[model samples]
Structures are given as structure tokens and as C-alpha cells.
Target: MNYWLVKSEPFKYSWDDFVNQGVGTWDGVRNYQARNNLTAMKLDDLVLFYHSNEGMEVVGIAKVVKEAYPDPTIEDPRWVVVDLTAVEKLPKAVTLKSIKSDERLQDVSLIRQSRLSVQQLKKEEFDVIISKAYEN
Candidate 1:
């Protein structure tokens, strides 16, 4: 299964909102690269829920409930979205600062492309972050 990271500001759409909704179509992605990432998603893929901007941390995990589909919110055929359901929140959030400092996470797309809202994650990178989040 492919791993991914999707970012949202807490005020715009927080992890709690996602949990409350049960499942949601991840939308509003305007950038071409981010849209391409969404198109790459597949059913049952795992996603990391990140609170960008204000929070700057990876807060929860989610699963792709549906594959890429035309984003219903717009008429643009170039845009698409994927359905995702909240799996669980991390015991401890892995902060951006911490990720930037970690040798294992140095090559993560999150640091290499700081402004990317949706991006791919290597399994090792994903595993390392999961390990860090579970660290006591």
C-alpha cells in the first residue's frame, strides 16, 4: 500500500472535524503537483493527517476509502479528490521542527517541498515518522 501525507490548517479543517465526519472527500487542492498526488491515491492507501501552518505537526492517520474522482465541488476536470477516513490520532504529534532535525526523515517530501499540501511518502519515511509519534 502507498503512503501519503496531506496537510490542512486546524482552523480550516482539523483532525477532530475529520473524525466527526467519519469520512470525507479530500478536496480544494489547486496546485497541479498536489492534484497529481491526489490522482495517485488508491483504495486502502494510508495517509498521514498533518496540521500545517499553526500546528506544524503530523497529528493522525487515515485510510483512503475511495480512489481519485472528479472533485464535485468544481467544474475543473483537472482537479480530483480521494475519500479518506480517520484511523487514529498519534499518541504524540511529530512536529516539523523535529522532522527537519531527524536524519532518517531528511529526505521526506515535507521538508524538501515545504509548501506542498499533498505529497507522497516513502515507506521508510512513513515508518520513521510513525515510530517517532509513538515514542514516549
Candidate 2:
């Protein structure tokens, strides 16, 4: 399955919020690239839940429960959303600073396109990050 990293400001939608919601639609993406990433997601795909502004770390994992559909929260019909259910919390958070400093992740899209809210992650990169989270 494809892997991805999706960012949300902890203040707005914390990891706790997602966990408590049980399952929720990941929407409100206005950027073309980020919206496209949501559209491309398939059921059961794994996603890294990253807290963008505050923690700047990947705090949990989630699985796509439903495929993309038109976002209900969007005024524009072009945008889409995906349903994701919390899978598990990371044993330890993987911070952005540590990821950027790691040689193995230098070429990751996250580092290259830091401003992108939703971005694809290579399988190897996904595995590495999850492993590192446990190691930490």
C-alpha cells in the first residue's frame, strides 16, 4: 500500500483528538498538491500523523478506512477527503529536526517540500521513520 505523511497543527487537531474521534475524514486541503495526495490515497493505506506547528513530530499512525470523496467541508467541489482511523501511537515521536539531520532521509519529499501539508512517503522511508520512532 502507498504511504504518506499528513500534517495537522496540534492546537487545531491534536493526536488526542483523532484518537478520541475514533475515525474521521481528513479534509480541508486547499493546496493542489496536498488535495491531489488525498485523492490518490487508497483504502488501507498507512499514514503518518504529524503534528506540524507545535510538536513538529510524527506522533501516530493511521490507516485509510475509505477512499477519496468530495470534501463536505469545502465550498469548492474539486477538493477531496479520505476517511482514516487511528492505528497506533508511535512509541516515541520522531521530530522534524531529527529527520532533517538524518542522512537516510535527506531526499525525502518532506524535507524537499517542507510547506506541503500532505506528501507521499517512500516505503523505505516510512519503515525507517517508524523504526526510528521505536528506537527513540
Against the true structure, whose TM-score is highest? 1
- lDDT string for model 2 (3-117, tens) is 9999999999999999999998898888999989999999999999999989899999999999999999857889999999999999999999989989999988779998899
Taking all chains together, each candidate's TM-score versus the true structure is 0.98, 0.97
Model 1 misplaced regions, further than 4 Å:
none
Per-model C-alpha RMSD: 0.6, 0.9
Point to the candidate with the largest lDDT.
Answer: 1
True-vs-predicted CA distance for residue 65, candidate 2, Å: 0.4
- Count clashes in each candidate, considering only residues at least 3 apart in sequence or on different chains: 0, 0
